[model samples]
Target: MYTPRTPRIVAARRLQRRKDRDQSGRFLAEGPQAVREALAAGVVLELFGTGSALDRYPELVAQAPEVSPVTDDALNALAETVHPQGLVAVCEQVDVPIGKALVKQPRLVAVVAEIRDPGNAGTVLRTADAAGADAVIFAGDAVDPYNGKCVRASAGSLFHVDVVRSPLTIIDLLQDSGLQVLATSGAGEDDVDSLLDGGLLDRPTAWLFGSEAHGLPEAMLAAADRRVRVPIYGAAESLNLAAAAAVCLYASARAQR
Candidate 1:
């Protein structure tokens, strides 16, 4: 195998400009697992650059058509982490379609609003893929679904699931589509397993999750046909966003089967 040449410059400076990602429609996805996931999901890789670990990933690289070599400093600039992985990829946006098809699907769906954290947003989408949810929608000022950390956190589910950035309210979308909406309120009034493994999966469902601090927007929950909570046996006040999503989506899938 031929050795790769490194890029000329190593950019230590963090380019915090707003339009950089928007302009390129690309973001930094770090780590081999993240890279493998993206490749498996069929994301259009604009560029793939690696560091010292390239030799360990001979098989993964063999699968890749070709890749550019990058300096650690250049990767550090774009990385969400301090100690960067040896590999980072620039990927094009995966635009998921919306409208009636979203509402018509038989699988349970997840919706997020004001989830500013890219990692959490990615987790929800990743959950959607695992639990076979029909789709995911980001309502209001949620994080960009295409953010690199989001994509990486998704573990490449960004390739399999339909993720929509919607201007319309989840309630309006639900109402128009004749879906039963469930909002996770953490109130512990009802159980999710009984709901899903029995009847909720029979009907088209849309699940809503909101900001970590604010929870679901009042209007969105008010429109919900049901507000459910994950039962707690422990003293923890809440669940991590990704964990909560995995539980919810899988419950719906188990119910349907």
Candidate 2:
């Protein structure tokens, strides 16, 4: 049983702090969903601090009763969120084995490339879980999968998803698998909604979304089996990465149903 430390942890108040995330390689897991998922993932809970409001998750706390309880004052700085969820855990990042990363035959996959934002990456993961997408592969230049903010943004879905990271060329893998490598383009041959419903995604498909500022690299755009765009009718310049992921993944969900 781990004994509780009284003095507070400094600089780690905000979950987004690089030191905090890097040190734990797990960051802070807060809220019911996040905490539940982390527990399911077999994350090593260094410490779990909670408030009376969250007595509802006793079963969850049972996973680690030695977990410390903290007042909002201590929890606030630890999480750095405006409203502390009353439950937070310092956990070790769950690592994925390379062999178990990919399924033998995945009909649908979410390929996240060059995605820098942790929140966006986390949300995409959540979307993948909800859509029952086969897997999530992080190509080169993606954000840390275990970023606290991302974990929080995912609302706990990361625990259920199969996330993989590989060095092979992403398009090469898809093409070799005979899967349609569709990329989300700001301006493309087909609109996103039309293609998703029209059958472009009917086969084994890999959906890739790029960085926000610059859509996708030219070479990658060229390699796409096809390109699809999400239409914007409102005054918004562009949809945020997480929102766009939800839209794209939901399209696959609709098709599957």
Candidate 3:
């Protein structure tokens, strides 16, 4: 079993940091599901697991290229969660430039801006995937999608959709792609249902979501082709970012279908 100080183990631990991940263009995918998806994507450079984990997923271990057996202490040290499923995979980062993703002329996209929470970030990715969005862009101070918390929250959906991290305003990209960029806000003048009923959802579109603590920025809202609010039927004060995204994306999905 590999010790905690093993070169491979040390390198994988370093990937837990954003600086190292950025420099190396690699991140750690923890748990069986994320590792399984990473393996299927053929992006896994190395795999690590305990004896028990290997025994459970023998087929996956057989397919993985660089497998390393680790002691329990090493595995625990590698995992970010209190209860890791005893598996982690080192994977190449899988993000493309926003321009490159836009050039494909996607039918639907989700743009998350200035979101700080990794759990929320990952949930949005999962929702976007479920709605069959062609891409998801994390822009403007958003948390890294490759963060351990985010990866776990996304389950395996992070592997299903194109993810882009960009500093330039996504409004410009959406406009260039001929997509209707819809900014979500509580005080929006347009209602989501009305827009959906008016054939707006049939068009190629991009949904803009902001941080939970703060809604969309004024400039972003202004830049959008239209600003729309999801209707609140009950006494709830406001929808969180993930809930709002699910409603908006599913509406677009249903309408397009």
Candidate 4:
């Protein structure tokens, strides 16, 4: 069993930092769900689990070629959550280029533009996967999709979709692929439901979501085919990035299905 202070454990812990993750071209996937997904994605380099966790999930252990049993304390030190799920894995980064992702001719794509919050970014990725989005583009200065909190928030869906990081050029790339890029904005001129009712959502679409603090920038809004607002019938000022993305992506998913 690797001790918490062992060199391998210390090295894995460094993955929690963006610089370290970038330097190593690797990141940590903590908990059973995230680790399982990482393993299934065929990106896991090493799998570490507590003895109990290894016994509890024999299926995972059987599938993993490089498995190590660790003490509970060692597992806790490696985990990011308050309650560690006793399993974690070191995995390679899987994000591909925007052009490669576009080659799939995705029916639905989620474009996250400058979303700073890791949780929000992760939630959006998870929601996008659930909505059957073929790819997720992290455009502008968006947070790293491999950030530990983001990975945790994604609940394993991170491995289920193509995640790409690009600049504002992502918008042009998405549009050039024959997709109608719609920016979700509070001041949007078009209503989401109205567009859906009008059959606009049935087209190959990409939904642009902005940061939590400020919505989409003016340039982004202008670049989009149209700006859409998720109707606020409840009198709540506006939906958060995750909620807005869920509504928009699901609308497109249902429309296309």
Supply the global lDDT for candidate 2: 0.71
Question: Candidate 3: where are CA atoms >4 Å away?
Answer: none
TM-score of each: 0.81, 0.81, 0.98, 0.97
List model 2 lDDT by residue over 26-76, tens digit each: 567777677777777778454445567458677877886347766656666
* Residue 73, candidate 3: alpha-carbon lDDT: 89
| Least accurate 10 contiguous residues by lDDT in model 1 | 7-16
Residue 66 CA displacement from its true place in model 4, Å = 0.8
| TM-score of candidate 3 versus the correct structure, residues matched by position | 0.98
What lDDT does candidate 1 reach at residue 221?
74
The better candidate by TM-score, 3 or 4, is 3
* Model 4 pairs whose backbones collide: none
How high is the CA lDDT of each candidate model? 0.70, 0.71, 0.91, 0.90
Tens digit of lDDT per residue, candidate 3, span 74-182? 9998999988898999999999888788889999999999898999999999999999999999888889889989989998888889999987366876888899999
lDDT of 4 at 216: 83
Location of the lowest summed lDDT over 10 successive residues in candidate 4: 166-175
